[model samples]
Structure formats: structure tokens, C-alpha cells
Target: MKLLTCLKQIPDRDTRYEINAAGTGIKTSDLTFEISECDEYSLEESLKLREEHGGEVAILTLGPQRAEKSIRKGLAMGADRAILVRDDEGKVTTPHAVAKVLAEVLKEEEYDLILTGTQSDDWSYAQTGVLLAELLGLPHATIVMEIRADPAQKKVKALREMESGWFQWVELPMPAVLTIQAGISQIRYASLKGIMQAKKKEIRNVELSDLNVDLSSIPEIEVLKVYFPVVEKKAEILQGSTAEVVEQLVEKLKKEAKVL
Candidate 1:
């Protein structure tokens, strides 16, 4: 089985984000990028499948040239190879445009299964993988928590995560898409030897313009603007007994904020 895992490089989860001078997006110069935390689950699961079932795992990502670092991390973790789709000059890449190029790449490689993260840390759009599934005309399910493969039947049984601790078992054929959820399982780390081996693996580069993508079809579905959350804090010391302070607090809530 050939498993294709889609990964993304996003700003570190704990990185401080400051709006750009244009107020359109966050400042990028001081940011350190890494693989989206949720995406790690997809990569780890794919690697495990390869180790257990004996197949290949490929990591595919689209971002600026620096994103190659994120791809190399996946390679060290156990992916057979990587694909890098790059755009420089700090221009934001759209998901639909990425799916277009991915469709072209998929045409040449026959994959048994495709896995992706449930959502990205940066955009949280949760649309790209599903969009890719649509473009490929393949059955897909998002928020998958567990995966079980049956090689003989060429089928996959996955446990999907939903609201309120709910889970549903789903069956998918060989060629299908799965967007994996965070906390599906623990992620493995890259060792020193694997890190050295990653340098020797192949990483193919591709351009958006070379994919026969029609510019007219791509349009902005949403606009992004970064803003700081409004925050205010006030503290008052209680000067009376516990019951008296509780009474005073209720009065303050009713009269000041009217939220009681």
C-alpha cells in the first residue's frame, strides 16, 4: 500500500503573533515554523502503517522554501520521500490552488490511502483535505481517531471522533481520504540516524503555474485580519465576612454588569 500523508508547516503554536504593518496578517520575519501539531498525528499514523503492513509513506506539503525543514522532519520520522510545493516573496497560498496542483501530482502516482490532519494550527480552515478529496472524487472522512487496515480486502476501518466523546466506525475502500484528529495516539520522535538518513531521501519540487490551473477559477472565499483579543481585569478585596462578600458580589454583578 502506498500511503500519501499531507502535512503543513505553520507558525509554532506558542509563537508570539504580532500584526503586520498592513494589519492584514501576522509578522513573519521573527517567526519559527514547524509542522502543525495536529498534522503530526497523520504523519505518525502513516509511518506506523508502513512499519506494520510494509508499504511506503510519502509526505506532501506546500509552502515557502523554508518549509522544506518541516518535510525533512517527516522524512526522518519514517516517510519514504517528500514533495515540496513552494512560493516565495511571502505571498499567502490558497487551499484551492494547492488542491489543483495536488490533483495533478496524484494523476501520476497511484496511492492506496491519503491521510491529513483534522485542522491546521494557523488557518483552522479544515477545508483543504476535504477539498482534495472532492477534486479526486474519493470518499473521505475527517476527525479520524483510529485506523485499522485489512490488506487482504484492501479496506480500511477507522474510528472517527465527534463531539461529546462520540466515535463512529467507518469503512473505506483502498483509495480514500482521511483527515486525522489530534490525540489519536502518541507521536514518535526522530532519532540521530534517521535524521541523517532523511538527507538522502528524494524531495520533489513543483510549481502552481505548471499544473494547468485556471486562474479564473480561484477566488478568495474569506479574508484574514489579525487582531488582539480585548482583555481587561479588575480585582477588589472583600472587607467583610464570606457571606457578606458574596452578597456584595451579587449586587455588583446585578447593578454594574447586569449579568446576574
Candidate 2:
């Protein structure tokens, strides 16, 4: 019944972002960070599963040193412990590289289930969880809205959300990975006592080198430039009698707008 949830730290949704001078990334100097919204749901799901099945819940995160704040918050929310893969150099940009690092850490551990957000807030790649599952050779389901675990039978049934308000049930054996969708469960707040106890919880930090992953070997999507989208506006008034105006509008739709 042991569960591992992957967490990520991202910029607050309300924060205004600016492209960096090199046009390669955003200027993060003044951005406020927090645990990603969907990841929070996954963490809450892990806590709920632990509560029902009587086992421990652990968090795994890969980010800069500042990410420890989010890990501590997860602990405060009821995670027993955490493993933080320090990436101060920011080398793990691609989803493949991230999955490789996480897979390396998971090699030494055993868990009945793994959870991750459907996608990250900043990049929205929506590929990390599936990639991690492939790397670990585990069965996985994405966009999961509900989970029913049978620890004794070593099987899990998940309800997956699909397009147009459709859902499908998927069953997988134990040691499976699931990409949790938001709104699957209500996230719990950290109580005062839990906050105090979180300070004493273990946060095992490891450098990227410790995992022996080579970032250069992984394929990456290059960002040639980052800029604000251009917006254009135009307006014209149709003047004439009702019949004339209708004709004019039709002509405009056929010629100027070309939408007819």
C-alpha cells in the first residue's frame, strides 16, 4: 500500500512573467513559486490512499534548492518523508531527462503505486508521467479521475477522464504509475501541529551527479525565441438603410473577412 507521489514547483499563476534577455527562458528573479496545482491533487490522493490502506506516503521532487519549500509543504500535508533531487544547474529541461533522473532514484526503492500530475503548469508538456512509466517498465494510466486500490490482490482500478466528458475504467497490476487529474480529491491544508512536525521530517537531498544521469544525451526541444504574442484590432461601421447594410455586411463577409 506504499505510495510515491511526484511533485514539482512552479511559478504562481498570478505572477507576471518576462522573457529573459537571451530569449531562451523566463526571467525568474521576481517570480513567486508554489507546488503546481495538479501536483497538489496527486499529493492529496496519495495521502488519502495511505489513510485508507494504512501505509506510508512519500514524495519525490526534482528541481532547484528552492523546491525544498514545496517538499516541506507536502510533508506538512501528511507525506511521511521526501527525496529531493537538487538541480541547481537547471540541466533537466526535457521530460526525458526528468524521467531518467526520477527512474534512477526509484531504482533503490519499492512502492506499490506511483502518482504524478497530468502535466506541469509551466511547460504543459504532459509527457513526464508516461515517460517515467516507460523508463521504469511499469503499467500506467493518464488523466485518472478516480482510483480504487486492492492491495491484497495487487491490483488497482482507475477511472480515466477522456474528451467530451467521457470516462473509461482501466485496471493494472501493482507497482503501477498513474497521472492524476485535478479535482480527483480535495487537497488538505497543513494544520499548525503538522507544520511544526514537518520541520522534523526527513528531506533527503541528492545532487544530479549522484544519480549519474547525462543531460546531454537526452533529446531536447530548443526554444529559438520567447516573446509576447502580437495582437491586432480593426473596426468599421456599416452605414446605410437596413437592406443596404445587410448587403454591405454580406459583401464584407465574402471579400474582406472571407468567412462566407
Q: Across residues 42-155, which tens digit of lDDT does each residue of candidate 1 receive? A: 999998888878889998887889989999999999899998866664443667766776776788787888999988998788888898999999998889999998867989
lDDT of 2 by residue, 196-225 (tens): 999999999988887877778787787688
Q: How well does candidate 1 score on lDDT at residue 199?
A: 97
Evaluated at residue 111, the lDDT of candidate 1 is 85
Which residue pairs clash within candidate 2?
Answer: none
- The 0-to-1 C-alpha lDDT of every candidate, in the order given, reads 0.85, 0.93
User: RMSD of each candidate?
Assistant: 4.7, 5.6
**Residue 10 Cα positional deviation in candidate 1, in Å, after optimal superposition:** 0.5
Per-candidate TM equals 0.87, 0.88
| CA deviation > 4 Å runs, candidate 2 | 232-260
Clashes of 1: 0
